[model samples]
Target: MNIGIIGAGTLGMTLGYRLSQAGHRVTVLETGAQIGGLATWFDYGDFTWDKYYHVILRQDEQLLSLIDDLGISPRMQWKETKTGFLWRGKLVSMSNNWEFLRFPVLSFPDKARLALGILYIQRVNDAGPLERVTAAKWLTRVFGRRVFERIWEPLLLSKYGVLYDRVPAVIMWATIRRYYKTRSKGDGKETLGYLGGGLKTLFEALERGIIEAGGSVETGAAVTEILAGEAPGVAVRVGDEIRWFDRVISTAPSKVLDRLAPETKLGAVSASSAPNYLGVVCLALVLKRPLSPFYVTNLIERGMPFTGVIEVSALTGTDEMEGNHLVMLPRYDEPDSAWFERPESEVATEFLHALRRVIPDIESNVERFFVHRAKHVQALWIKEPPKEQGPRHTADGRIWSVNAEMAGRDTLNNNAIVQVANAAAQAIGAMGAPAKAPTAAASRGR
Candidate 1:
């Protein structure tokens, strides 16, 4: 089978490796110069690390299995990470039961409701009902109005921005459940894992496996059009070059794939009425010292520009970064938001100014700063439940949609991505794609 995978991110390369091992000629295409997508590495002057903060959780079975398969499990580093929450201009630890119980913002009734709600939702097998309800409504009902106003709403604003009010409760349920399940045993503190060289190591390993298995991974090769003509195969155009493929598996955002391959109508995959994705703009900084004792600090300060603070070096360690701390201030919003259009220096300055409220002496400890942005981070499902819980083969049955929208009730983590990759591999293996022959999919392979 001559398989063309659009986007050379973790999912695309994983698919490429699987199909190539199955004896298919695979080609992975990426628009950017780099491969890993959001998980790609960057040069931070003294060191290179993941552009965005990523960590392996204790409960990330799929990701762990992939790492083990890559023969890099021995290089895995694990640590008990602390979590903090800011409220009323004060930073407080909330990683344990005692700290949570001592959290003053919540009344006894509020605490009780919050506890019971969490206990109930943890056992929920289906997220359909949650998706029908908005997060604001669900939180207010389960955790009380005071808790919603004081803690949840502000926290939600950081991630969802303008869409917070319309976001489904299932997302919040899934996110909290994912986070809590990762808590290490005994002390209840979450244990996070990191590779020796970070996510770049994992991505590179996947890329290598694809190439070694006779597949090709091409970067800076933006696939502009995919035409499933009246002919036998799909014709893909990269610049002026048009090539035929037995089957096309697009890991692109739903909307993007629709534009690339309009032949499918793609309604079964993503409709025109579907919600737009929430993009991320992160203001990353290297510091001479750690900003906080906790790796993640959930922000609630009303005027803070960014949502939360991630002390990535706390989990990754300063050893790989010349003993300098790496922290990221990320804002999640619409891709075309005014903030995204603003100057990078202006965004950095605003974020830094607000950060001082949490860390009074931050400027003195800062070493270097960088800005990273991604337009399609994850689909933002608002008000209504998604029509289909998983990606479907388009009407033509030639293009497979394996994107984030297919991840039912799960957070956008590497584990979920690996699960999607494995599922797609199994499904495609059952299909009767064209016989394995010349590598038309990667005719211009690097």
Candidate 2:
């Protein structure tokens, strides 16, 4: 079967590799010069680093399995990571039960409520009617207003801007539960995993697998339109050439895909109002000394223009070629936000201000800085939800839709990838002599 994938991010690359290995002709269309999408890396003359802050949870099995499958198992490394909350002009360690108990911001009763709320979310499998339920109202009701105001609201406002109230309570619960489950032992310490060099190694390996299996990956080839006149096939427009495929799996954002597929009324798959994504300018510093021993710090003070989840270089256990430290400051806001398009000097001033507050530093110790911005980081998908509508996957005859945002229930999990891969295979495989027997859906590929 001829399959065309719209994007080449981790999800796209992984799917392409698996499907190509199943003896189908696979082709990937990437608009960017490089692959990996949000998981992409940039070279800084001396070292290569990710444009935005990225770290894997200890439970990221798909990434782990992919590393080993590519024969790069030795490159995978893990470390006991620490996180802190910056509140009232001090860094309060919040990575453990003991520290959480001692944190001074919340009242004793409020702290207890927060604790109970965390447990409730983890234990409760079904979050009933969470769509109509807003996170702010739900949290404040369960954990009191102080917790919501001090910790939760700021984080939501930082991530979602004015749409903070639109986030469902279940999202908040799911995020917390996911975080709790991925910690180190019983201590609340976060465990982080990183590939030796960067995720580019993994992306390259997946690319190789796809090509070796007779799949073609076309870079800088953006599909302007997808014609679905033929049953079980799509006509993709490339410059002047039109390529046809038996099936199309779009990993591109639904907003982008909606424009490409004109034959169907894509039913709110392309949202009327875009959900806000923070534009990030990552300043990767090769410092003479490490900034902080901790891996992440959530900015709690108001006036600090950025709330970055910092990644200390030495912690990821990568080789320090120059014996220098690596640190990244991620600033999230709308693309049109003043900071996103700020002049270099103004942006540098903000970076220095945030750094000085956290790290006791000499201005002379700075080594390097780089800025990167992703226009559409993640789908805002800001609909009121018991059921949060991402992209709609209408069964348009032979045109089967498999996108990252539409992979139901299991998100960012290896199971989700495997599930979509199997579903697409089955959907396409059932289409007569045009296809071959694909691998059966399993937790792990044989």
- Candidate 1, residue 238: the lDDT equals 87
Q: Candidates' lDDT values, in order?
A: 0.81, 0.67
Q: Write down the TM-score of every candidate.
A: 0.93, 0.86
Q: What is the C-alpha RMSD of each candidate to the true structure, in Å?
A: 2.6, 5.5
Clashing pairs in 2: 131-385, 131-386, 278-333
Residue-wise C-alpha lDDT for candidate 1, range 164-251, written one tens digit per residue: 8888898998998887787754666678889999888898888888888888888888999887765346667887787677788889
Per-residue lDDT of 278-345 in model 2, one digit per residue for the tens? 44555566666666667887776766766655756746643633455667766666667677677866
Stretches > 4 Å off in candidate 2: 229-233, 267-281, 312-314, 318-322, 360-362, 384-400, 407-426, 430-446
lDDT of 2 at 339: 70
How many backbone clashes can be found in candidate 2?
Answer: 3
